[model samples]
Target: MTLLLIAATVAVCLMMLMAWLPEFRAEGALLRRWSKGGGENRCSETVQNVVDGFIGNFSAAHNLSETETARIREMKTRPGMMPVTLLLHPQLVTREKGRFGRGRNLTAVFVATGVSALIMPPLAGMTMHTMSLWLLPFLNTSVFFAGLQLLRCAYSDLGLLNMLVTGKPD
Candidate 1:
């Protein structure tokens, strides 16, 4: 039973590293674009304006009210806002959790790893060898990193939105 639990914990951590780490690294690179006066924002704006112009003209031709156009113009000011807004919405967040299920599973794995690491040394006591003393601290660090990894996607999206909305990092 103890060996099985240990194996399961190791599997969970490996899974997260294998599945999410590459994507996280790729997306994390975009965070730098959130800096003030970044060139990426300038590029994003050019695209934003084109989209807004298209939408505004479409709405006007369709006989939509000026109020509708105004609202769309307001929305147009914030590039990449709609997708983030939709993904982060309460309903969509729940649906996302249901769809991916990675975050929750990763959390459980990290927590379990931390707990077992913390507990094993004391439970095994004098029987624990020198290397075992380091396990608890290593697992504690792993827990912290795992949490940051889990939040990377949401943080990246928010950073992108901040660049779009405020034209700078917050």
Candidate 2:
């Protein structure tokens, strides 16, 4: 049973690491593009679709006027590498004066996971046993990877905002 728990922890760590790699890769490309100089909209159609969807959602959520939402679609970074709406429409980045901020997603995830770590063992009916000990390692590993992923997402979101504001990804 202990060995099984160990294996599960290793497997989850590997899986989570794999899941994060693509985000980092894409982020690197975004950064390189911004560092060089923003240019024509290089983002894929899928990304454009995602931005459009966000515009729709943001308009609905904020009860934006049709003219206001239309302006969001026309907004683009100075380099024109991607749509500025990608940053402005997201609640995580939106701020007063038409700017962006890190917002609370990353911090909230960290705090929630920390609280859950303290709360889960007791809820699982585990006491001070060898299994419980193994559980701690697994839980720690899970929290570490989960936090890492959330951090990566926040980093990417902020990277986009930086690119929009400074017209540079770096």
Candidate 3:
């Protein structure tokens, strides 16, 4: 039974990993589509430009006042720590849900991995070493997704990652 589980897990992992692998053509196509106006209806360029200007102005002030002055008193202090504090507060608990959900998607890819990991061992009918050949690929894919998820989350924190959080407005 364990061997069967191992084999299934292995195959599933490989499939998921392959699906998630980087494809230059696919990425380039997506970039071109977005540039041509795939999502321009979601937000106007004027709005984005205004937001960018506001963020730039605030960031400059934040850097000059909080970072520069605080640097003289302590080396370990960071000026941008306050944003993270808001993220931790009750008014902002959704951040954790969003983070864990992203993480869970990465981990959920393991369901296939675990199945493959379990199936490979018994299918081969080898009793001495039960480890499936698929385990490495499973782990590798999981790690890859985990890293990608983290990158997504980090971009979101920087306000550089934008997605349609809701359906289009009628």
Which has the greatest TM-score? 2
Off by over 4 Å in 1: 25-28, 31-40, 44-128, 132-140, 148-170
Model 3's alpha-carbon lDDT is: 0.36
Compose the digit string of candidate 1's lDDT tens values, residues 28-123: 223222322233334466445444545454454344457544544454334444322213211212213112123444455446545545544443
Candidates in order, TM-scores: namely 0.37, 0.41, 0.26
Pick by TM-score: 2 or 3, better one = 2
lDDT-based ranking: 2, 1, 3
Count of clashing residue pairs in every prediction: 0, 0, 23
Clash count, candidate 2: 0
Cα RMSD (Å) between model 1 and the true structure?
A: 10.3
Tens-digit per-residue lDDT, 1-170, candidate 2: 54554454455545444434433555434533442455655566755565566557756754556766665556534335334323332444444454445555445545545654554454344425445454645565475657655555556655655554445555
The TM-score between candidate 3 and the true structure equals: 0.26
Which lDDT tens digits does candidate 3 get at residues 1-170?
55544555455655555534432244323322433453354435653443334334433433424443332213112212212211211121132322212233334444544554444445445433545444454454464454454344333432311121111221
Ranking by TM-score: 2, 1, 3
Q: Where is model 1 poorest over a 10-residue stretch in terms of lDDT?
A: 89-98
